[model samples]
Target: MQTITVEPLAQEHIQILRLTSTPHLSGGLDTIAPYSVWITYRLNTGANQHTWTAAVSGYRVLRNGVTDMDAASIVLTNLADQDTTPDWLTDLIAKYTPSW
Candidate 1:
């Protein structure tokens, strides 16, 4: 799980509802591949209750028999600045990478 900080939204409140991952299955039954990981997060905001889902994908590297995933490669959807990656999101992705 990721620790998300509620940043000041200028009269708006954003709440992260859920975070889930859909892993790519390998050839064997119930086997998961670490190459591709898809992470999805649902969020609700403000009084009107606007909700949205963001999906991010990244590949994990297997080096020295250890699995490693880079958060910098994970791209988040619906961000104001696509070139700039948020710290919180990077932390979240790093925290969840081990589980995948």
Candidate 2:
């Protein structure tokens, strides 16, 4: 007879672990465009952690490279759709900004 062992399922926690953005330059110039934001967030789940990226210009969001509309709506609502930029994103941009 063979013995088998099984591990318990990991707890699920859907939270944003990290957020990053890449600003696109306008026509290869130094100017950044509002619509050229590409936001990527790490969705942390104990055993199913993954990253999602969204294009603010096209309103397209993807999870692990596949289209996820529900996440898209959530990302847009909390990030781009707001009247003002989210503080977290603003801070991230600031961190990357060079002070001269």
The numbered model that scores best in TM-score is: 2
**Cα error of candidate 2 at position 37, Å:** 4.3
> Per-candidate TM vs. native?
0.22, 0.23
lDDT of 1 by residue, 7-97 (tens): 6442322323243454432221222223333444333334332222234333443434333454223334434433343454455544543
Worst 10 residues of 1 by lDDT: 25-34
- Which runs in model 2 stand beyond 4 Å of their true positions? 1-83
Write down the TM-score for model 2: 0.23
For candidate 1, give the lDDT of residue 2. Answer: 100
- lDDT string for model 2 (57-81, tens) is 4223332443333322223333334
- Model 1 TM-score relative to the real fold: 0.22
- Stretches of candidate 1 off by over 4 Å are 1-83
